[model samples]
Target: MTPKEYFKQAYRLDKRIDSQVVKLGELRALAGCAQTISYEEKIGSPNRNTEAPFVKVLEKVYLLENHINEQIDKFVDLKYQMADAIETLPNVDLGLVLDYRYLQGMTWEKIAEVMNADVRTIYRWHTKALQLVQMPENPIII
Candidate 1:
């Protein structure tokens, strides 16, 4: 794959991780809601097999949390590999542009603002950075 496509994979992994994190949060919230019951509330309610479903939900939440952590670790490793590739470029401007745009997940406008350069210059730097990036033989998997 080309450098642009390779870097885009990182962005996509980040998005996936973000989505999973949201799901994990929702699951944890569900688990929390399942666990809370005052003594009066419990006394009023009938004795039913509530533990089975709550246990299942808690188990699912745990599995999902582990999966999200694994995905995040993969994303971090991929970002590091991309950073190493970006470091190979001789132009510091190009490296900075790539770091902000890909590793830091910054918008082009934001990068321009931070670098004190025009948006056009940021785009130019991005293009140069893509041309200069060199990946290893086995490219990182998204």
Candidate 2:
């Protein structure tokens, strides 16, 4: 894949992951609310210790959530950086390939169906896209 295509794919993946992050954030907020409610209930009852372990668990959850958020932020920043790097390519056919494959999380066969191309073509586009955006001295797409 060309660097531009790779960038496009990375951007697409970042977007999809961003949405998932938002949903996870909402869930974390809901869990926090539930934890608060549990604590309040325990305060009025004799199960305060039962709530104690939960509070600790909630703390760990928040910690992991924070880590995930940080990772997402980094990914988003990388997306923008890559976009800036490959802004000159106007004939980029792999843009959609990247979007469908990474951002939309579509399988190669599915992308082939949507683009009216064969799976082999889609795979070629995907690989070309990755090559465009590949980091120096690193094969990792992300």
Candidate 3:
């Protein structure tokens, strides 16, 4: 993968994790709503079981949570690997730009504001940083 793409893995994973968490929340809501006291009883094996839906939703939420946790772990590891790679660059300014843009997930405007430089300069530095980036020998590809 290219340097830019390698660095973007963390960002993409983070977004994926966020979306999964939202889904988990929705699932939990559904599960909560499923908890209703039923006055009627099933005389025999009904067409479908009432508790099945809730159980399935709960199961999905559980699996999704596990998946999200695994993704989060991968993201953290990738960030550490990326940080080590960025530190290999000789230029501190370039490294800082990469850290702000990639590691901290800062936007161009925010990076520029924090760095006390113009947005154009931030862009320039980011370009240079990407150029200087040496992809890890065994990058954690998504």
lDDT, candidates in the order shown: 0.85, 0.62, 0.89
TM-score of each: 0.83, 0.49, 0.87
**Rank by lDDT (best first):** 3, 1, 2
Question: Across residues 60-130, which tens digit of lDDT does each residue of candidate 2 receive?
Answer: 66776777777677676665555444343344667677666655557878899999999998888767766
Q: Which predicted model would earn the best TM-score?
A: 3
Give the per-residue lDDT digits (tens) of candidate 3, residues 41-137. Answer: 7577667675655888889988988998899889989999999999998899899999988899999999899889999999998898899888889
Best by lDDT: 3
lDDT (10s digit) by residue, model 1, range 26-69: 88888777455656644445766656557887899889988988
Total clashing residue pairs per candidate? 0, 11, 0
Q: What lDDT does candidate 2 reach at residue 36? A: 29
Candidate 1 regions exceeding 4 Å error are 34-51
lDDT of 1: 0.85
For each of the candidates, the C-alpha root-mean-square deviation to the true structure, in angstroms, is 4.8, 7.2, 2.4
**Shift of residue 51 alpha carbon in model 1, Å:** 5.6
Worst 10 residues of 1 by lDDT: 36-45
